[model samples]
Target: MVTKSDTNSVQVEIVPSRFLMPETAQRLLCEIYKNGGIRRIMIHGPNMPREVPYGPGKGIPIEANRNLLVEIGDQAIELRVKVGRIRLEMESEDYLGGLKAACERALPFSFQFRQGKFFHDRMTTSDYAKYGKVEDERILGLIDPKAKKDKLAILSEDMVTFKEDEER
Candidate 1:
């Protein structure tokens, strides 16, 4: 996990007026990262599955056209949802102006930015049982502190994958 002091971190919530397309989201993410000072970013929206979950085609792979290939710096990331709200954590409050400017430039639709704590701030029962009491409050949230990385994801070129018949 990416360990850093979140005590002074500032959360900026971006809610778009409408569901964002894959290309739009990718563009916006790139813009935000380019502006710098971002510690973590969480994209939230309606779940989009790779396969049909129920009915006669329950086991079949979904032919979705909205999947995105987002590039952050040199890393390629896959975005699986029709982005609705984006929550970002910055190192400090000083980066707010740049972030807001980036958002305005990248997002064509109207958006709202609010500052507050959107992520978990304390350890839960599951965290204590799995990792025990941790001194760092930054590692106390829903994400696994010992995990490989905290917020970023490296994705392959192909954005979609099909499930085997038996696995479904």
Candidate 2:
């Protein structure tokens, strides 16, 4: 029974995380390493999914936890950021890569939902209405972290259990 108005009062923030350039897949990092190093960089982290055009999307949404929402997608998940840093090898792959890797190693992020001052995720405040409220169950069966490694799956489960558990 959550209403759009309920969300109007909420704000969400995407906690920023680092990306290990090589961690994604070896293929993408070859050029970066061969060139020695990259100069200057910009990075972006993933955010709560706002409403998109009414076309079918790949997966459902998941709120970070019960009550307050910190939205994240599983299928067709967006990398929270648009830009990022380049790793230079000082000692070992895991070193430069690991520094970023360990920090980046959070793999998927964790969320905390609060009642007041919804996190904005640096989103355009004016377009806030387009972003609808979401629930945690939306993420259950969404991602197969092992198979895709990169993509997460929806947390699919029985609707009755989901709703019932959501309240607790």
Top candidate when judged by lDDT against the true structure: 1
What's model 1's lDDT at 12? 85
Whole-model lDDT, candidate 1? 0.68
lDDT of 1 at 13: 93
| Per-residue lDDT of candidate 1, residues 49-116 (tens digit) | 67887998896887673345666677655566678988877888899999999989999878999998
lDDT of 2: 0.28
State how far residue 42 of model 2 sits from its true place (Å): 18
Model 2, which residues run further than 4 Å from truth?
Answer: 1-17, 20-74, 78-116, 120-125, 128-168
TM-score per candidate: 0.73, 0.18
Q: List runs of model 1 lying over 4 Å from the truth.
A: 1-6, 65-67, 129-168
Worst 10 residues of 1 by lDDT: 159-168
TM-score of 1: 0.73
